[model samples]
Target chain A: MLHLVLFLVFGAICVAGAINLLVQSHPISSALSLVVVMASLAVEYLLLGAEFVAAVQVIVYAGAVMVLFVFVIMLLNAGVEERTKGSRVALILGIPGVLAGGLLVAWVLIERTGTATVGLGALPGFPKTIGNLLFHDFLLPFEVTSVLVLIAIMGAVVLASRPEPKNPEKES
Target chain B: MLSLPIFLVASVVKIVLVIFILLTAVAYTVWLERKVVGHMQNRWGPSRVGPFGLLQPLADGVKFLLKEDLTPPHVYRPLFIAAPMIAVICALTSISVIPFGTAIPVAGHIIPLQITDLNIGLLVILGVTSIGVYGVALAGWSSNSKYSLLGGLRASAQMVSYEICLGLSLVGVLIVSGSFSLQQIVESQRGYFWGFIPKWNIFYGCQFVAFFIYLMAAYAETNRIPFDLPEAETELVAGYHTEYSAMKFAMFFMAEYANMITVACLATILFLGGGNGPLFGPPLLRLILPTFYFVAKVFVFLFTYIWVRGTLPRFRYDQLMAFGWKFLFPLAIANLVVTALVVAYRS
Candidate 1:
C-alpha cells in the first residue's frame, strides 16, 4: 500500500515536471523542471532495486548533464523574455501525441498483466550481470554508442568554433 | 495496529537521533576548525562565548538566524531558495550509509547507529556527494552575479575533475575488498598485515598510493583549502554564497562542514582500519574501543584539514586544473595498475 502511494506520487511529480518543462516560458525553468523529472525517474529506478543504475542516473543526468545544460543556457544568455512563443498549431497537434502515448502505455500494462508469472529466481551478482550483458550480448551496440558519443562531441566542437560569415564582398 | 504504529515511531525516533548527531557534529566541527586554525596561527580564537568558546557555534547559529535574509534584485528567487536546501540535504544524506558504532541493545531492540545500511553503500555515498555539486553550481548561477556565477563554474569544474580521480582511487580498494558494501569492507579489515600492522588499505603498498590520491582528490572534491579556489575570499568574495544571507547562508556553511566531516569519516573508514583496533580487553570493551579509534582517526584528518587551511596558500585556477588532469589522473591510473598486478600475484 505504501509503495503504491509513493509510486503514484513520484509518477505524478514526473508527469507534472514534464508538463511544466513543456509549458514554462523560461528556458531556465524548463531546465529545472527537467531536473525534477530526471530525479523522479531516478527514485523510480531505486524503488525497482537497480541501485547502481539509479545512482548513475542521478550522477550523470542530474549532476553532469544538467549542469552542462545550465552552463550553455547561461553562456548563451537565453533569458525568459527570449523564449519562443508557443504555437497553437503545436498545441492542436499535441492531442494526437497524448492519445498515442496513452494508448502505448495501456498496451504495455495489458501485455505485462497477460505475461505475469511467479517464482522468478534471483539473478547473478548485479555488477557482473550488467558487465556481462554489456560486453557479451550488446558489445557491438555499446561500441556503436561510444562512436555516436564521439561524433556528437566533435559536432559540438565544430558548431561552437564556426566563424560568423563576413560581408558578401569579403566572401568573394 | 500496535505494530505499525510502533514501527513508525521507532523509525521517526531513529531519524531524529541521526539528524541530531549530524547537526551537532557539524556545529562542533566549526569549533574544531577555529581552535585548530587558531593554534596553528599562534592566535586565540573565539574565546568569549562559553568555556574555551565551546558555545561559539551556537552563538553563530543564533546570529545567522537573527540576520536579515536578503534576496538580490535580479536573482532567480526559486532556484536561489532551493539551492541551499539541496546542498544541506545531499550533504547530510550520505551519512545514512556510514556505520557509526556497533549495534546497541536498547530495550531488547538492536538499533544500528546508521540510518540505513544499503548493500551498495559506497556507491550511494558517491552518488549523493556528486549531486552536491549541483547545489553549489545552482546557487552561483541563480544569484545573477558575476562573482557568484564564476564561483559556481569553478566549483562545478573542480568537483567534476576531482570526482573522477576520487572514484578511480576507490576502485583499487573495492577491487581488493570485492564488495561495495561499507560494512563488509570494514569487516574484511579485521586481520593483520605481516603480523603487526592492521590490514587496512593504507598498509598495503600500492593501496597506500591510492589512499593518498583519494585523500587529495577528496580534499579538492569537497572544495577545501588549498583547492578552494571557488570560495576564495581573496578573489571571489565568498564565492557561490556571495549573494546569500541569513539562514540560507548558514545552510551553505553547515553543508560545507558536514561534507568535510563526511569525507574525513569516509577516509578513516576506507584507509584507517574502520572501527577496528587491536583487541586489548573483553568483547564489549573491544567493540567500544574500535568506535573510539575510528572517531580519533576522523579527528586527526579533520585537524589536518584545518592545519592545511592555515598553512598552504590557495592554488591558481589553471594550476588546480593542471594538477588534477596532468598529475593526479595519471598517478591514479598507475596506482590502479600496480594494485591489480599485486592482487593478481597474491592470488
Candidate 2:
C-alpha cells in the first residue's frame, strides 16, 4: 500500500516536472525542472525494485548529466526564451496528433498486457544480478556501447582542442 | 522481523538522533579547524569564548541568527534563497546511509546505528553529494556578481572533474568487498589479516593507492585547500557565498563542514574497518566500543583534513584541473584495472 502511494506521488511529480520544463521560459529554470524530472524518475525506478539502476539513474542522469546541462546553461548565461508566434498548422494538427498517438499506445499496451499487475520489487535488480547479466549475457553489446562512447569522447576532445597555428605568436 | 509500527518509530528516532549528532559534529568541526589551523600558525584561536573556545560555535550561531539577512537588489530571488538550503540539505542527507556501528538490540528489536541501509548505500552518498554541486553553482550564478559567477563556474567544473576520481577510487573497495552496502563492506573487514594489523581495505586488499586517490578526490570534492580553486579567496573574494549574509551564509558554512564530516565518515567506513576495534570489559562496553572506534577513526580523518589545510597552499585553476585529469584520473583507472586483475586471478 505504501509503495503504491509513493509510486503514484513520484510519478505525478515526474510528469509535472516535465510539463514545468516545457513551460519555464528561463533556461536555468527549465534545466532545474529537468533535474526534478530525472530525480522523480529515479524514485520510480526504486519503486520497481531496480535499486542498482535507480542509484545509477540518480548518479549518472540526475547528478552528472544534469549538472553538465546546468553548467552549460550557466556558462552561456542564457536568458528567458522569447515568446514566438505559434504556427497555424502546428496548432491545428499538433494537439489532436499527440492525443491520438497517446491513445493508440495506451490501447495497444492495455490490449496486450490486459490489466496484469506485477508485485513491487518482483525482478532481480540486485547489483550482482545486473553485473552478471552485463558481463556474461550481454557482454558484446556492452563492450560495443563502451567503444561507441569512447569514440564520442575522442571526437569531443578533438573538436574542443585548438589546432596548431601556422604562425605561433612570439612569447613576450 | 520488526513490526511496521516498531520499524517506523525506530526509523524516526534514528533520523532525529543522527541529524542532531551530525549538526553538532558539523559545528564542532568548524571549531576544530579554527583551533588546529590557529595553533599551526602560532596564534590563539577563539580563546575569548568559553573554555578553549568550546562555546564558539554557539556564539557564532547566535551572531548569524541576529545579523542582517541581506538579499541584494540585482539577484535572482528564488534561487538565491533556495541555493543554501539545497547545499545544506544534500550535505546532511548523505549521512543517512553511513553505518556508525553494529546493530544494538532495543526492546527485543535490533536497531542499526545508521538511519537506513540501502543496498546501494555508497552510490546514494555519491549521488547526493554530486547533486550538492547545484547549491554552490546556483548560489554563484544567482548572486549576480562577477566574483560569484566565476566561483560558481569553477566549482561546477572542479566538482564535475574530481567526482570521476572519487567514484573511481571507491570502485576498488567495492570490488574487494563485492558489495555496495556499507554495512556489508564493514563486516567484510572485521578480522585481522596478520593477527595484529586490522584487515582494513587499505592493508588487506592493498588498496592504499586507492585510498590516496580517494583522499585527494575527497579534498577536491569538499572544496578544501589545494583543491579549493572554486572558492579561492585571493581571486574570487569569498567565491560562491560572497554576496550571502547572516543565516544564508551560515547555511553554506554549515554545508561545507557537514560535507567534510560526511567525507570523513565515508573514509572511516570504507578504508578503516568502521567501528571495528578491540572489545573488552562488560557487555555494555562491548556494545559501545564499535561506535567509539568509529568516532575516533573519523576524528583522525578530520584532523588530517585540517592539517593538510594548514600545510598546503591553494592550487592554481589550471594546475588543479591538470592534476585531476592528467594525474588522478589515469592513476585511478590503473588502480582499478590492477585490482580487478588480481581479484579475478585469485578467484
Isolated chain B TM-score per model: 0.95, 0.99
Q: Is the docking of candidate 2 incorrect, acceptable, medium or high quality?
A: high
**lDDT by residue for model 1 (A12-47), tens:** 999999999988988878888998899898887766
Model 2 residue runs over 4 Å out of place are A111-114, A167-172
**What DockQ was computed for model 1?**
0.53
lDDT of 1: 0.85
Which ten-residue region of model 1 chain B has the weakest summed lDDT? B1-10
Scoring only chain A, what TM-score does candidate 2 earn? 0.88
TM-score for each predicted model, relative to the true structure: 0.89, 0.97
lDDT of 2 by residue, B1-347 (tens): 78899999999999999999999999999999999999999998888889999999999999999999989999999999999999999999999999999899998888899998888999999999999999999999999899999999999999999999999999999999999999999999998987888989989555999999999999999999978887889988999999999999999999999999999999999999999988999988999999999999999999999999999999888999999999999999999999999999999
Task: Give lDDT tens digits, candidate 1, residues B269-323.
Answer: 7888788887687877865887788889998998888888999998999999999
Summing lDDT over every window of 10 consecutive residues in candidate 1 chain A, give the lowest-scoring window: A116-125
